[model samples]
Target: MQHAKLKRSLTVFPIVLFGLAYMAPTTVFSTYGVVAQITKGMVPAAYIIALMGMLFTAYSYGQMVKAYPVAGSAYTYTQKAFNSHIGFVVGWVILLDYLFLPMINGLLVSIYLNAYFPSVPFSIWLFAFLALITIVNVIGVKIAANVNVLLIACQFLIIIIFAFLSIKGLLHGMGSGTLFMSSPFVNGDIPISLVLAGSSILCLSFLGFDSVTTFSEETINPKKNIPKAIFLVALIGGGLFVLISYLSHLVYPNFQSFKDPDSAALEIAVYIGGNLFQSVFLAGYITGGLASGLASHASVSRLLYAMGRDGVLPKNIFGYIHPKFRTPTYNIILVSIFTLSALFVDLVTASSFINFGALVAFTFVNLSVISHYFIREKQRDGINTIKYLVLPLIGAGFTIWLWTNLDSKALFLGLGWLAIGMIMLLSITKMFRKQPPELSIDHAEVNEMQA
Candidate 1:
């Protein structure tokens, strides 16, 4: 009997919306103070830099997804572009994020909830939120997408209100007393190095765009929609990040004045409106958490399903999709189980691993585009040179620069985690004597696809 395949129920819009939710649009507020401080109130400029970097890499992801429209994402692309062993390693490396990102989401939301309902145990908040996320994912992708759309809408609503109030406050002489200010995007006094530093930090905000590629199997016309969705998600997410930070800089020109850089958004909320707005802001934050958790939970589960279906991981548990629900049930549960680690793990430690795997995946995906198209196919004629080689080269350069700029703590921990993945890869391939199992696509779908 053939294995139950992932159902195709998505299009460009839903996946694009899901990617926005995964990026957690409201998160710009949370980190506003820190970024402003880093860039000397040039958060908008930093976001622009970050957006450019993501766009270059986003172009590469778009290209590769067109060639190989499968759920494996970076791992599949690298493997096919190169070899199974390298692909196995990339997939294993990506597991750092795919496995724990859901945990981070659950933990953060639980932290916020625990603060509101201090009487309730942190574990209780974690479990309740995780349960909701798990149940939604287990049900189906369409249902999960619908839930995220609601949550994403709520976040955007909060952001819109905050922006309107900030503008109102500016008109009434609350901040710089003027609307247009170039200082946020460029300051003669602030060094470019600091702006670049801030951009590196903001790049994390662009993380979820690539996660969209994991849904290729579920997307209608994977070749068309998947590539379109990847670029759109990155552009929308980056644009939102830039706009929010710019407006915020105008409203609160003094980045150094906040007592707590961490909760700076709360101060901005209360300043623009009042305690009422702050309360509304907190409620909206819950929606951000919900959106991020639901999206990440769904994405990681799909990655696991892809690897499991390929027999690189245990096929029975990770590969099996439900016949009725058409979801990867066991992998969903496993991701939820991994989320339990949130209770004990701190944010810093968990985040370190994610950046490493995320960067490696980004770097290799760019290389995969070049490896598959430029070198492998020798598509150097005319437009193919720019399409195959130049764009991905720029993309790879940006990711490599971003990799170099990783915080020492992140670099240390990321390299350590990568070492572990290498060891695992060696054992899986028996010391390079054999190839890792190749990813098997649903050929029925591939045959239907046009060349």
Candidate 2:
């Protein structure tokens, strides 16, 4: 029996919308208070720095997708650029980012819902979101993409309304005496160290753009469209983050005034537009979280399918795609099961689990570019040295810097996860006597190119 592959039905626009959904355009609001407290009102600057760092990494991803356009993303790139053993480990590490992020979003949605319906248990909301998102993913990627577009539109509408209200509030003497001020970008007294620390957390808001590469196999003209989608997602998402944060900061110049930093964005909403608009804002926030969960679920299932096909995981399950829907049914179910953990974990802990894995994957992706072009190819493709070397070096440096600033608990948990992956690698390689298995993609590539 022949197995169906993921269909290449997605274009640049739908995939870009998918990327924004995965990033959850409204996440900046959820994280704004924490970032504001850290940056001392320089939230925009922190995002600006984080955006620059992610763009460099995005460039590296663009280069890699051109060479190996597959669903494995960082896993496939690292393996082809380096070795299978290292690739296995990279795939294992990124599972933290892929598998757990939807759960984090679920937890966030539950919290928002519980705020309104105080009597309903959080577990009910969590499971409801998981079930809905899982079903959408299992149905088809194109359908999921359509759902994302609708949900993201709602989120963007809410953001635009909030921006207008914030501007009006500022004009009415709600802020630092004028609509324009340098405090949101910088302050003469605030230390640069504080802003860098804030950027570390804000970087989480930028995580979803890289996941766009996971759709490479299911994208039309993967080589060209995948790169364009990746860049557009980063630029557009980062611009939204910076603009919203700047406006929020203008309306409430003093970060110390927040009663609870975690829910500061909601407080800003109430201040700007009163109770009715607060309800609208919450609707947008919940919609953004759901959209994010749906996109993340789809991306993670594809990653698992890639690993399963390579025999890195149990091929019977994770590798299997539905003959009718052409989707990874088993992997989608598996991720849905994992998301149940959201009922037990709080938002902070769940959110912390992802940053370590993401930073590690990004750091290596940048290095992979250097290894492929600078060391292995010796710039033989006539690729500019600056493109292969200088830019990626800067990207690597910034990601590593952010990695160091991760909270202690995140570092410990991430290291523990890596240790488990190392043991699994040893067992899979049969004590290092044989190479880890990999799927043969030469035939598929030839067919795709010919078509």
Candidate 3:
């Protein structure tokens, strides 16, 4: 089932768009609202700082991807940097995170659906959204990418429209302020603790960029294009988010009133454009969320195919690729089934089930970056070492700090989910009588690489 490389159909631009599309507008805009509250109005500044932090880690990822472009992104990087065991753990944690991301997006879409049609049950909305996308994912990757390209274009247009409207509103005194309300960079009694807290939350909106590497096998020019797409996606996505966060402050200066994390941006849209534009805004947001769900579905399915091909998972079940399409049809369907089931769980649990896995994944990702550098210092010397080692250490430390600050229920639930994933891993290993091997790609010893 394994191949030498991804098909040459997918270009860098489309894949980068996929990453950006994964961070849905509602997710991005609402995240800005939450960060606005936490930072006490230093919303954009916080994003800028976080962008700097993310850039350091991104550089390391860029190098890693360039050296070894493979489907199991973090798994390959961690294994190459550290060892197979740690790499397997990284792959496991990332898979756990990716599997639930679709459900999170679906549940979130349902929340927005409620605002539009109060009579519709959120559970129904969740299931319908999950099912539709799951089917699309199972159909094939090219079809899935085509869908994503359209969705990304739509979402990008919406954001552009939003920026135009918000800027016009600010210029015409329709908004609360022009420049930031306070000395945003200087002193506003902004707590360091709060910024740290908000940055962690903001990290969620930026999580999907790394998932691009899951397409390594499908990308046209894997080595050059993969790294290019990742850096550009992160750069563009992170930059736009910062701009939107700044724009959000102009539209909704009173961030204190936005205690409700979920609907914060919707409230801003309502306030900024009134009822007429709110409808349009919400429509765009829903589209963005759906796009995000679809992207998550596609990426995770590829990860499953990669794992299965390596004999770590149920090879027969997951390794079945469609000969005509060259797509992992069975893996996609299996992931869809799980995600669809998760839709129900998310609706009932209110989606706390999603964030915990993501946090755990982020924690390990940061740790992987740090450990990879320390282990490969001689090979990865100079600024690259500091960029890899130091930045990831900060990211990891900050993530842990935020993890501690999460609500008690979240903490408990996250731990419980981790335990469950561990159990699942144990069961799978025992069933197969073989553990997932560590991922490694020595640049010096490399021939052609495949996902």
Give each model's whole-structure lDDT: 0.78, 0.80, 0.64
Q: Order the candidate numbers by lDDT, best to worst.
A: 2, 1, 3
Candidate 2 lDDT over 318-429, as tens digits, reads 8899999888899889899988987676555565678788888888899998889888988844456888888888999999998877766778988999999888889989
List the candidate 2 regions with Cα displacement exceeding 4 Å. 1-18, 69-72, 118-124, 127-145, 211-229, 298-346, 380-383, 438-451
* lDDT, candidate 3, at 447: 15
Best by lDDT: 2
Q: Which stretches of candidate 1 lie over 4 Å from their true place?
A: 1-15, 110-145, 211-225, 294-352, 438-451
| Model 1 vs. true fold: TM | 0.80
lDDT of 3 by residue, 1-451 (tens): 8667436678898888677765554457745555676678776776666566555455556666655666645556666666655555555655556677776777667777775677997778877896788667665534355765676677777678777778888888866758545545445477776676566556666666776776776787788888788778778878888788778777767778864545677777777777777788788788777766776677677666666676666778776788876767887677767766644452313233444455555556566666655665543567866666776777666556655655456567667656665666666567546665532322111112111
- Per-candidate TM equals 0.80, 0.82, 0.75
In model 2, state the lDDT of residue 44: 97
Question: Over the stretch 128-194, how does candidate 1's per-residue lDDT look in tens digits?
Answer: 9988988888886444446656877888899999989988998999889898888888789999888
User: Model 3 off-target regions past 4 Å?
Assistant: 1-26, 34-42, 69-72, 134-145, 183-187, 212-229, 256-261, 298-377, 380-388, 391-404, 421-451
> Candidate 3: worst 10 consecutive residues by lDDT?
442-451
TM-score of 2: 0.82
